[model samples]
Target chain A: MQHRLCFAPLNGLILLVSACVLALPMPASAQDKVLRWHDNLDRAAQASRESGKPLFVVFRCVR
Target chain B: MNGVDLARFEFDYDTTWQAFFLDANLNVYSRYGGRDEKSADGRHSVASLQHTMNEVLVAHERRRRPESRSDADLQPAPRSKTTPEDIPLLKAGHQGCVHCHQIAEYRALQSFHDGKFSRDSIFGFPLPDNVGINFDLAHGHRVDAVVPESPAAKGGLAPGDVVTRVDDVPVRSEQDFRWALHRVVEKRSVVVTALRAAGSKPSQPVSIKLDFHADWRKTDLGWRKSLRSVPLPLGFLGYALGREERRTAKLPDGRLAIKVVSLRGGGLAGNLGLEKGDLIVSLAGRSDERTLDDFKSDLLRRYAPGDKVRLTVLRDGKSLELTGPFPPWDTTDTSVP
Candidate 1:
């Protein structure tokens, strides 16, 4: 009975640690740092106008 | 790409990736990406991109200044918006999404059929390395090395000098420099303005005149996706024989020796009875040392559609001659996919 009692608290502590770890936010990856790319050139241009920032338009042919 | 203004978004259509740094009013500040025959992204790097972005930001900030407001180039010029749908050839046949390469291909085809195609148009966006100036990958505009006895060296472009402008075009990046080179129509000499930085003093702009050779714009076209639209088809896939293979075939050193691997159906070679495994020893009696791509380019340069072509082949140690008219530049297929 004493041995069971001793192991029960240890198991609970392990579960608590795992839960804490899971609750922690994920670190941002290198890809996450990339600026949001807009497919619509007009919309992007509009954003550029509103923000007074220069537009960086990229054309990439996937095939 | 359908409704986008192609005139404002002009770039090398042969490239898979290209970028333009412009303002909201569509005043282009610079460009970022370019490629050679080596590879698509070989000339680009993250550092170079970062450098271009920083330079664009600086230029944007300068334009925003009160004194710079009067700069004519900073003002957006009025242009009639032309889209991919505006192109008659594309409008007639293509539907749905239109690729960048298709734009180049259809336009070139239109030019070809209209009897206005220039051979120089095939070699678009020639690299600065062609002029003997190798830009530092990280700095984009700074010359890292100059080829010995190249035009850049002859023109007094030294390493560490930052290119400011090419002719009248303000060069802010390597792609910008290439754009300047691409715009050279008949001028054999180009004036390159660069800023030479000396120790603890302001940079001074130095002008260098680059005298180009007749073939300065020529580059390897094998890597281009738009090369297919040129209408010159070899009708057979050839593999260049290695040094040992050439020796085994009893071919002379430093000469053309390619093994025909496969023949295209209804192709000129197939029509002329060119079989697989036939070793091509010479083309038009010219046994020059040339790669398969080089040989293809040679054909494009020397012959047009329906031109006569002659090839000498070896089969089982027996020499055979094949001659036929080159295939007509077909316009039936306009789709890039």
Candidate 2:
């Protein structure tokens, strides 16, 4: 019983890892490539809120 | 505890009186064990209904009443056919299949430009691809928007071109026209005839071919459930934006300037500051010269949202830089229509 209980969690962990491994390869969506402006999310958050527009886009130059 | 119970619980693990005791226990275990467990009263109701149906069926069967079984036809049907006449068909037919099957709406409105947009590929605004139909209902008699730059576009089929014939077939009704389309060879360019006018006597014929790869929005005759949201071709992306042309503007030198009249969605307007009757001239910094294709790639594939955009606005004749984030594609407004 003890071994069975322990194995269930281990099996779950393996299943989760497997699922992520399967989903890792697709290309990013139009909304997925958000550029990070500042180290903290504050600047991005303020821009999004103040933009008054429902959809706010942030592009960063990563030279 | 027994083999039978295990099997029974495995299948009926979620419902029924037999599983009722296990439900509370499972809830307790989940809450304590840090596992998520949930239930729906709908299932219980459905299971009870199923039990009642089964009992009725069995009772009727065991009674050996053949006549009564025949009488079952008089009983009300368990399910009603969903034939809602109020619902207009989204597609050419009364079928609503494409709208239901295609869930990717609120979807991508992209243009068929060279390379997909990346950060370095910010072409100012996203370029838009034209609809596959001619929106004019008048020309709708022949063909809708011949998809932008598609084989139909390249083949010479314009928006108002009334499709009168396909090779030799006469397209009287939508069905007749569709049948002719079915007969055409995929990717083989063929001549098509259209009346060109609602009351025009002689029909003008033009040739167009299908490309090897078909646009996803093409309404191929298919089976569909009738109950679905109305389908709008081009996914609601209308042809060329900036229709409100000939408006006023203020130049940076306190003078008047040219306002960008109209713009298509997934186009450069979604990125630039030159709104209706504003002013224009000078893009990016220092009046960078850019091509239409170059400006479109950025919005579609490259940037997400909240990116800094610097545009040189020639408002009032003073070259001042207008700074703002690119407007997220907001086509929600019906005002444009």
Candidate 3:
């Protein structure tokens, strides 16, 4: 009976840790394609020039 | 690894996020994104973004045809007051992780150093809601809400109507709407083209003539970067209660109950015996629709600097009436305890 009581608390702690791991947020790249964006402005411009497409530029801060 | 030339394009410095739609040659076709003081992403919408992208594509095609191109085929961006390299903070070798707020703050500091600080410097660009059109960005610049009896509603703008164009500029996003509105300096009627039931049943075009009243420029200020020396907009030099705050104070609804939390610059409010915890019930002999936001907007939009305004407040559970002239935005001559 004493060993079973000790193991019960251990099982509860493991369950709690597993729940927390599951609840962790996914990285930006895993969630949205927009978040996983390219940062090479020069490449974007070059592509625009070659393909005759307008270069869409965005200026912002992650913080 | 190149940087966007900041001097060529004009953007709302107060906004946290801004985007530019340009031709391959760097000629700007239009802009997107805008925010009001209440929310950081107030007027942004995905549909508006899609619309702006479509317009830019069309403008791109027009640029190729020499005969179809006119002097205004693709307009050059307006020159800004300062460039990114001109800002001291940006020039300090920390421009890699540049934030939008820092750009505005540094620009204002440079403006003050150059002796060009004005009301427009701190106020920046006014939100489109000032004209009473709450654009739904997700629905492609559709009307989300219209202020009752406002110029938008009276001009025939209804909810769910898609704004296709403002004046001669193609309306795609909130930024385009603001850009068009910003160009209108005079108090003239603005033409708006909206389509009802867009992409659904038979759609019809609606023309709206939005007329502005005198003193419309005094509407509301957006969040802007300013130096500590720059006093708050409209010279109040104090803070007012928000809606949630009123409920916490047990103040009744449908009446203005602004709790004066602090007074600064020894301005008129502090000089006239107004202190912290004073609840303002009425101003200018008007007590109807008394909310702090509404009152502040009305006070600033209706009165100018040096104009005296009457106020009634409840301090220490006692009623008091105070009147004083509006103070300048940079008054440091007076001090308060």
Candidate 4:
């Protein structure tokens, strides 16, 4: 069964402020296995230039 | 410590996750993320992400033809002020990759300081539920659920209803819903047309009358992503105390309180004499009886930068009130914390 996350009660201010201290930006490759991801945007841009494939960028927090 | 990609694609910053599909030329084909305060993954699904990827590939293929590119497609995105390296704390000693929250705060603070923080910049991407409709993106952006007693439900929306249009725009993806919701600000009504399917029967046409309160757009402006060119609000950092903690503090029931947890050095709050460990009970005459979320929305949506705001705080078991000049939202001021 897929567990759907509920965000109804969380405060945006709390979440954003908390991320500064509680969360760190980590490479998606370290956690997600579905797609081989790029941690750096410039590197991804460079790779896109070479392969002509579109950039699948996920700007996220690893909290 | 360096600022990178802060001005890249337009993103919904309040959302915990934002996925974008773009070409090598920086052309944004589409986006695949939507979030509200309730769920970190609001409206986001693996199926939708994969669907967007496929659409992006097709858009790329079409762009190969010279005629496919239009003036709208060629426009360059605006740039943001002050990169990560320019931030004093990061430049001083803060190591590791810069977090999104840090970037969000810094950017908003810069915009706030620059005096450009406005309704649109502060409250950019509103959630779908602001109108009481949740989209099931996996099933062609169908109406997954409607909040009971919400504008959607009041207008006659039910589960399994497929949203076909919001206002006059066609709704094919979550982004389309965002585009529709974007035009609704303050107090305004929007026409939503959907297809309702009852059991195994053929779907019937349904129209939902959706209107939002003046503060609806204000719902979570603090989390909305600021565009590269837009300004921001006050740069102080604080968190709402949990219910249990509020009870432990010996406060009256149902009073909304925010505890000052951290402050950026030279941040507006610190500069204005607000300190860490201070318990904020009220701002601009609003007290703890209101939810922190509502209080924040009221402050941001109603007040402008430079507006003098009276603050009430609880410190060392003493109740105190203080009034000060709000920070100047000057984005060009690089001296910000």
The DockQ scores of all candidates, in the order shown, are 0.23, 0.01, 0.20, 0.28
lDDT per residue as tens, model 4, B1-337: 1454445555555456665566675555555666665566656676665554554566566676687854332223445544676755345544666655455555555555555445554565666777787777685467789899887878888888877677655554676567557655544888888887766888888877886765566555433343332333344567777778888898776676888777765534743577778888877776746544455565666556567767888988898887766564444434222
Interface RMSD for candidate number 1? 20.1
> For candidate 2, lDDT tens digit of each residue in B187-212?
34446555554354664445554342
C-alpha RMSD of each candidate structure in angstroms: 12.0, 26.0, 11.7, 9.3
Candidate 4: tens digits of C-alpha lDDT, residues A1-63: 012222221111011101222344543342244334455666666777787676655555545
C-alpha TM-score for every candidate: 0.77, 0.21, 0.67, 0.55
Model 1 TM: 0.77
- What TM-score does structure 3 among the candidates reach? 0.67
> For model 2, what is the error of residue B196's alpha carbon versus the real structure, in angstroms, after optimal superposition?
4.5
lDDT of 2: 0.29
Which 10 residues in a row give candidate 4 chain B its minimum summed lDDT? B224-233
The per-residue C-alpha lDDT of model 3 at residue B306 equals 74
Query: Candidate 3: where is the Cα deviation over 4 Å?
Result: A1-27, A31-43, B1-4, B65-76, B79-81, B84-98, B102-124, B127-129, B132-138, B142-168, B186-210, B222-230, B233-250, B253-265, B285-299, B331-337
Tens digit of per-residue lDDT, candidate 3, span B89-131: 3565443534445556555555555556554444445566777
Candidate whose lDDT is highest: 1
